[model samples]
Target: MTKFYSLGDSESEQKRLLRQIDLYGDTRGVAFGAANRVVELGCGAGANLWIARQLSEGSYVGVDVRQGQIDAARRRTRDLGIGNAEFQLADAAETGLKAGDFDALFCRCVLIHQPDPRPIVTEAQRLLRPGGRGVFIEPDGPNHYMAPGKEALMKVFHARTHYAYGDGRGSPGAARNLYPLLVNAGFKDVTLTPHVIVATGDDADCCRAFLRHWMEIIAPVADALVAEGLITSRELKQALREAETVKPDLFICHTMWQADATR
Candidate 1:
């Protein structure tokens, strides 16, 4: 789908993600204490996998559909001497990992790409042991962040991008929708923890990085904005320029749903 994450060189994006993760509080989403083995879906370049390995002192497996991404992750694990972590090329909907094989599952910014998150959520539920937890994190849609005038163009660009890339329904409106969806997948004791990117001075650079990446991601769609009548080509260009110039508010609220299912 929209591989906005694959915008830059693998290493650069990896470092950026690691920094963002650290800024947002690394250990909060991690489920430990009785949990040992952890599996992270859409584990690009092993950033979170590396952290999870240290947090658990147990087995860690990262699954992604792309072989190139998997290879990159493998190299990263070896370079870091993270023996506890491994990478596998597999779809989250059907990873073929044994039922109840993982003590916990971590998914971040990946479910939006799936046409149907139901299968993935169902698989996650099946993969976890009874009382085990699964944490799902995703960006609240682009519409949530932009101004009313900017929001219209952003939506058009997002839709066109999805059509161009064959991705279904860009991201969900917010992480809040995840709680009910998880419950539908048969998860219990579900707790939805919402997280927003705190964009302080130090966090500004990272926010800017994401904005640049987003511009690239929506480039194709921007080209068609005029034809679609959603926004003029000039307006689209201005939006891109402004996105780069203006600093994203440190108080911007982007919700990430971290749900813990007992079992």
Candidate 2:
């Protein structure tokens, strides 16, 4: 299996937390008051489960393929004295979880890494009870924006990074397929919502921080690109340097697609 970006690293963990806050904090009433069983697929470090705890009085189950992330999640829940959250090491596509048992299922930024997301969606449908809801969030890669001078280099970086995952078999633009996938998987009342992040002027610090975190996440991919003779070392360094130098007019728009449906 292809490895995800910067798994088990402090920087990646921080980025995950920031992303969770950015995505969930601004959106209100994400969980139902009556929800009693919730699950998260690819719940890296289980940050979202912690967030879910605040929204619903549910017992939470988080599943990830990485043992290291599972260990970290276990420690995090234990340290927080949360008794209702459980972490398991398992594949998202075939989690072996009970069928028709969960009240809600959530996944974020995970389906893009899969070469075919149908299995995961199918599994989600199976996992949810009748009238249960499923929420999925993923990036529409082609719509990602950056400052004028940095767009081309970042595009190249993204393309090379996508190629690194399963030799280009992964879908970098998986967000666009969420609606059709959910519908095809027998979900009803599917709805799509787009969340676009555009930072400018006073948000320069936030933009810089976001870009820096991305750089850190992709550093290993940059090294792999060089080793594969896909990009020159100097080119990678130049791109990194440009990302580090923030300008007042710096702007980036990342549009994430969120799809929700009932099983």
Candidate 3:
């Protein structure tokens, strides 16, 4: 069965993920100092590959399902002269790597793509040594909102999310319920933190970038939604045009949750 992956493997998507790392890195709560061996599940294009630099005395491995992303990750790390990192093409839920081999595991924006995250959670637990730590960041899909009204954009978002929730894809709102999942999985020190992305007139460039990200999300899913009768082609065109014409004063806010646990 095929599922929808947001902003699929385009060269431009790689650049966008890199930019997203710059935008969200500071808040990522990854305790790199304590981690000697690290694994990043769903590590697209090595967006957070800089984590390798911080682990000068350690090693890092990035795993992703997309071969293009795995290849791009290797190329980017090699070209940038960043070492101590390896990229593997594998499904996050079942990476064929050794069990209990890593001391720390990090996942960002991965669970939202999994309709059932339990398998991935189990995999994370199995891969970590006793007392090993894991940090996961996932967006709060149902709660993301924009202010000052762009009804068309909202409609597109609704269509996109609704479509995503179908066809074996996971819910965008999966992050909020992670605590119980981790606890039930026997992970200790389970913690949840909420982070918000606020793009307003105060941060003009950031706001624009936020808008672009929002529109880019729609582009990939628009056709799927149309085919499913969730949206019309004309609606997609209008939404994209409105997205481009969004004013500098536009206000959009999104929320993501960070889950920290120990095996």
Candidate 4:
């Protein structure tokens, strides 16, 4: 299993995960209304479930492999006094959920972590009723980059980061492969929608948050990268410092592909 670089139950990490969930949760069109049963796989901290609750009065179930995450999610639900949302501890690929039990299955940034996303796709397919929807959001690894001028800096940063974490052993390019995976899983009307975040001067807060998220992800592996001579400590610090400094000319684009399909 590929370890999650941002793995932790710290308040800061939880806050970051919630911020990320808020950032990417509703970009795709997956309609949720009254009584619509929705399940989110690898639902970290139940942030997406919180979003789903606002959109519908439906019951929401969030599953995660980590008990700490599940506990935090449950606490969040309770703290918010949200009665319709629940969290469970389970593997994304084999959730032990009832087949055809859900009206909609949603996942975000989950597939990229899996070595073989097909199993989770298959599970989603199995869980949804006929004509039910599956909304998956994932990163297109290779396309995550900064524009020219800062290209050299980004290149080294990405190279070291990817070397330590990018390839999930199964499908590093899970976002690009979502359509085929859905089709092969017998889903219909699989539509791919691209959600790109171009962080420039106007998006200063977003840009800072994005870079801080990257900093958190890279921190755990910094020592290893330095030891391997993949990236110097100074170079890593420079990249982080640059990420913090968002200029008008700064162009950083993070693209996430959202694929919606019908079972």
Decreasing lDDT order of the candidates: 3, 4, 2, 1
Structural similarity to truth (TM-score) of each candidate: 0.77, 0.88, 0.92, 0.89
Candidate 1 TM-score over all chains jointly = 0.77
Say which prediction, candidate 3 or candidate 4, comes out ahead on lDDT.
3
Q: Using lDDT as the measure, which candidate wins?
A: 3
Encode model 3's per-residue lDDT on 21-77: one tens digit a residue: 766543455667634899999999988876787787999999999999999999999
- lDDT tens digits, residue span 15-124, model 1: 55555566556346565643388888888766685455555557888998877678878887888777778777888888888899887788886777665678888889
Q: Count the backbone clashes (under 3 Å) in each candidate.
A: 2, 0, 0, 1
Model 3 misplaced stretches (Cα beyond 4 Å):
25-28, 247-249
| Clashing residue pairs found in predicted model 1 | 131-263, 132-263
Clashing pairs in 4: 115-170
Stronger candidate by lDDT (2 vs 3): 3
Q: Model 2 over residues 1-263: C-alpha lDDT tens digits?
A: 32454334464664565465554333444654444688889887766754456544578889988786787778778877887888778998889899998988888878887777888889999999999989898877667678766754585457564654445466676898888898989999999988876776467778776776567556656777778767778778778777877777777777788888999
Q: Determine which window of 10 residues in candidate 1 has minimal summed lDDT.
A: 1-10
Quick one: best TM-score, which candidate?
3
How far off is residue 243 in model 4, in Å? 2.3
Lowest lDDT 10-residue stretch of candidate 4: 1-10
Query: In model 4, which regions exceed 4 Å deviation?
Result: 1-9, 24-30, 55-57, 147-153, 164-170
Model 2 CA deviation exceeding 4 Å by range? 1-20, 23-29, 151-153, 165-168
